[model samples]
Target: MTRPKREPRRPKTVWLDDDQQRAWRQLLALVMELPAALESDLQRTTGLTTFEYLVLANLSEADDRTLRMSELAARANSSLSRLSHVVRRLSDNGLVIKSVCADDGRVSVVELTKAGMRRVATAAPLHVAKVRELVVEPLTKAELIGLGRAAEAITDRIADSG
Candidate 1:
């Protein structure tokens, strides 16, 4: 008689040690809380989510306030589907527009509208203030530099792995 197949055992979750746990929790809190705080400020002032702000910010810095959809998705660190949803919202809000790429008919390009520029300009100061209040104000100058370096290193590692 043929034997039935057995399922593979699940790997155990590795719980962090005390020191590691503390740092991990801190990082987790920062990742979750900071964005919520920033989003609150953005919503209160400009009626935009943090994601919307990122999209507008990316377009604002792009050549002629425009970028191909794929590039924008990479820069925003979001999936194409998520980017599409946000872009549709922004388009509906008159903050951005989408068009067929000139160089590649199959590709799409997203551009910031003048209204988006004005809105982002208005939101910039508020967003900066909130960031300063939550993250920067708590760190020393040296700590700030270290934090930036650490973030860059993490980003580089992710890019390398990708």
Candidate 2:
């Protein structure tokens, strides 16, 4: 049998006030646009989504190109379940491996495969260029610094509240 459809959220309950609306729209646009743009570039050049690339990049930079699954999830801005799903895909692609952590039997760690390292090395420059083209070059150096600070502040706020 088919499942019943879920009801949609009512607009009045979810809608934002004027200032919140403006901020929400701008934030939403950045949220949607930035990932799509970066992911497209990554996909075009390295055949990976931004999320996948982030997974590899984080692993590659970690000591031994590895991290505990729970930690990797946090660093990659993904949930443990989502990270597991992605890691499974990466494992299938032979770009990452998951196994029991030596220090903690209950935990798993993810490590970059040699192929994943090579892929990230090849993709990093092109990804950086795309970032410059879409985000960095348009701003003054001061604005760039401010952008970093603002992003960190927002991240902290989100983390605190979340």
Candidate 3:
């Protein structure tokens, strides 16, 4: 006689316990509020949105103050289309220049103009002050290190999955 067929196994659902739930809620609040706070400060002080500042800052740090459009998008944590729009605006404002790469005619590159560097230089101190006030000052050194490790782990997991 043949044995009966085994049913497919269902995946286990791991629900958060009360303490875990509380911690998750706290994290959720930070995730929602932190970016808004940073954006507000940056916008008010620098007339640049957080994303725009990120794009400018990345270019400022890059070799020759230039980066490929795709690389800049990844560094800025933005989509290519979004970066294209932002670059267009920056180009219009004379803060950045986009051109075909000399080495690779097919690829586009963005260069931070002297004006772009000046913009970031003016903005960096204010952004750093806001970051210190909102994030660093409140945390003890140990807590700050732990937070960095946790962020790294989460980012690594996300990158791996994606």
Candidate 4:
């Protein structure tokens, strides 16, 4: 069938104003730079990548030092595949053990070994010190609280969008 050609509609685009632009750029820089800086310090001091540290740390904080694979992935903000790969590495190092859940054989669970607990314990202070130096010490308490609120709001927005 013959039809008239029509222009495709474009979505409306809203431009950021100056203050929003500046704030966004600053946020972008922080997002890119802060993690790298923290990872560098953690690697130098603890011989652990940030992801590894996070996995260990998260496990350390869980009930009985254990969590199901999916739950761990969520807590660490990682995909199940990536978490499984890292868990494999940790298992190889005897830092964590993975097994089928007793209650649900379909589910896998991870538990921190004594060695893993020790590793996280040792790494924690160094990590906290670095965090304090880079993030906390520079800000007043009120500003830090406000920052926390802002971060929570941003994370909520992201979670809602997804």
lDDT of each: 0.93, 0.92, 0.97, 0.98
Across residues 12-54, which tens digit of lDDT does each residue of candidate 1 receive? 9998899999997988898898888888888998788999999
Model 2: how large is the Cα RMSD against the reference?
Answer: 6.9
Report residue 106 deviation for candidate 3 (angstroms). Answer: 0.3
> Mind sharing the TM-score for model 2?
0.82
The TM-score leader among the candidates is 4
Instruction: Provide TM-scores for the models.
Output: 0.86, 0.82, 0.92, 0.95
In terms of TM-score, how similar is model 3 to the real structure?
Answer: 0.92
Minimum summed lDDT over a 10-residue window in model 3 is located at 73-82
Mark the regions of model 3 whose C-alpha exceeds 4 Å error after superposition.
1-10
Rank candidates by lDDT, best first. Answer: 4, 3, 1, 2
**What is candidate 4's lDDT per residue for 91-137, written digit by digit as tens?**
99999999999999999999999999999999999999999999999
Write the number of the candidate with greater lDDT, choosing between 1 and 3: 3
Q: Please, what are the lDDT tens digits per residue for candidate 2 over residues 32-109?
A: 999888887789888988889899999999999999998999899899999999999999999999999999899999
Q: For candidate 4, what is the lDDT?
A: 0.98
**Alpha-carbon lDDT of model 3:** 0.97
Question: Model 1 clash pairs?
Answer: none
Best by lDDT: 4
lDDT of 2 at 149: 97
Tell me the lDDT of model 2 at 5.
Answer: 97
Tens-place lDDT per residue, model 3, 48-150, is: 9999999999999999999999999989888999999999999999999999999999999999999999999999999999999999999999999999999
